[model samples]
Target: MVADQFGLRAIPTVYFLQQGQPIDGFQGPQSEKFIREILTHILQTAEELKIAQATELMATGKTAEALPLLKEAHQLEPKNSDISLTYAEALITLNQLDESQKILNTIAIQDQDSRYQGLLAQIELQKKAADTPEIKQLQETFAQQPENAELAVQLALKLHEVNRNEEALEILLTFLKKDLSAGDGSVKKTMMDILSALGSSDPLTNRYRHQIYSILY
Candidate 1:
């Protein structure tokens, strides 16, 4: 009856239940050590679990998805260098360069490992990428013709090319505020593209999307 209730079909089944509901489980004959390890993990604190999950997300190149989790984990464990490094990495991926540098700089000297050095190098690269002469030229052109929807969209597109997505979206949204369907909706189209490129998991993407909604409704 117990097996039937859970719909058990395997001979060796393990289930970790919390609050009368299963939170994790595995099926198969396993060593006692493996089972003990699973139990140990199940007993870990929320902060530990969050950092572990965020690390996995970061490993999979889902930095946007990991950012919030890592941010929470960092808040929970401010003194933890590993968590700080990960949060900084996620920030860099999202182009929050200054914030990322600040976080990285706070790590203790003894805890500054290879990962810390790598993040520093990454910050420099991102800074250099965000300052190309062409982007400057576009900025100048856009400034001279701020009301030109076509020029605004063109400059925004150029910004997007260099991973400056937030700025790209801002330029487009600024134009959209004055003329929602600028250049036959090309401006909104570009905004959508920038947001999409930022990924659904990115907070800025969500925020800007809400701004777009406000413009529409």
Candidate 2:
């Protein structure tokens, strides 16, 4: 039954998987050299493997899906500038200007290569646009009326306009944490909208969805 489920037909059919998906397969006997190459590709260091996966995600415009893997790779090996740069690049894609800048800042003077500079430049340019007058004004007013749910929603809307998604989501989540049913469920609704905008594949969507489920269930 299992062999049929996996579509195995030949006696020596074999499949190799990475991250739970089949990446390579051979239906008949293979040369030792070819088999060794497959083993080597699958046996790479965890950090590099993550970076490779993250690179593919970023290349395909799946920034949200790529971010957690890159972050994990960074945590596993902080000294590897390649991982840090990949993580930073994802942050830039998500318009996480502050976090991306912080990561770029960690690179040593010698390791401040072209990729680091490019990410840094992107953050600087985006940060300037992000520090707009409307956001500034809304942030100031929201800071003063920290408990006002209406004001919180207003500011979150502004943050969402410029693609500061994580920041906007964080602001909404904070209020939701305080009062899950605040504003007659409008607060939760706003969070749902943010998650929807973040896409179903996003790690943030899954993480935040679980958080909301935990509170309700």
Candidate 3:
């Protein structure tokens, strides 16, 4: 009736129907740019809503539930690195290292950002004590990426595992002198562990020997 009254031959219409009632409609297909602008606005609104819900869940100590929502939002927008990284972090907080490592590994491969690379290094180090070829392979894989404080520490720890304290000392000392806050405190803690493992009697150990002595004594 409206189209006939407007003397339109053909009218394109968009309808938002709710329970068979037309709640909203657009008269015609908009231009590509206008449609894209509308879609972008809708997507941003959805992302914000999901982020707010996830944050609420996390605050309420329902991280388990929050994780899946965050994962969905991330899947909806894989280009959002923060969402991906936050999902990995939430998984870590939930003590799901395997899942977290999987996400982190993807980011490390795609982004190769220092933060993601450092995380992969830390995860590998956690598995360093395993007496298997896999641990060695993991270390070698990480060595190919850009070096960070944590990577340096993990490489040092791997070197020490092969009974090369001098090289490990170099890595640990180098990490200690840098701004490693982006990589968490794992680098510093690993340095301590390496110093303890190296023992005070080793010549390369002299640099941190006093600090080690204070800690153990």
Give the best candidate by TM-score: 1
Report the lDDT tens digits of candidate 2 across residue range 1-217.
9788679878688888779888888777889998888788767888888888988988899988888899899999998887888888888888767678778888878899887888888888887888789889989998898888877887887887887767777888888888898767777888899889877755567878888888787
lDDT of 1: 0.85
RMSD (CA, Å), candidate 1 to true, equals 10.0
Worst 10 residues of 2 by lDDT: 198-207
54-81 per-residue lDDT for model 3 (tens digits): 9898988888778768878877876677
Best by lDDT: 1
Which candidate order results from sorting by lDDT in descending order? 1, 2, 3
Q: For candidate 2, list the clashing residue pairs, or say none.
A: none
**Candidate 1 minimal-lDDT segment of 10 residues:** 197-206
lDDT winner between 1 and 3, please give it. Answer: 1
TM-score of each: 0.62, 0.61, 0.37
The 10-residue segment with the lowest total lDDT in model 3: 126-135
Off by over 4 Å in 3: 1-32, 35-39, 42-48, 108-110, 121-217
Model 1 clash pairs? none
Q: Score candidate 3 by TM-score against the native.
A: 0.37
- How many residue pairs clash per model? 0, 0, 0
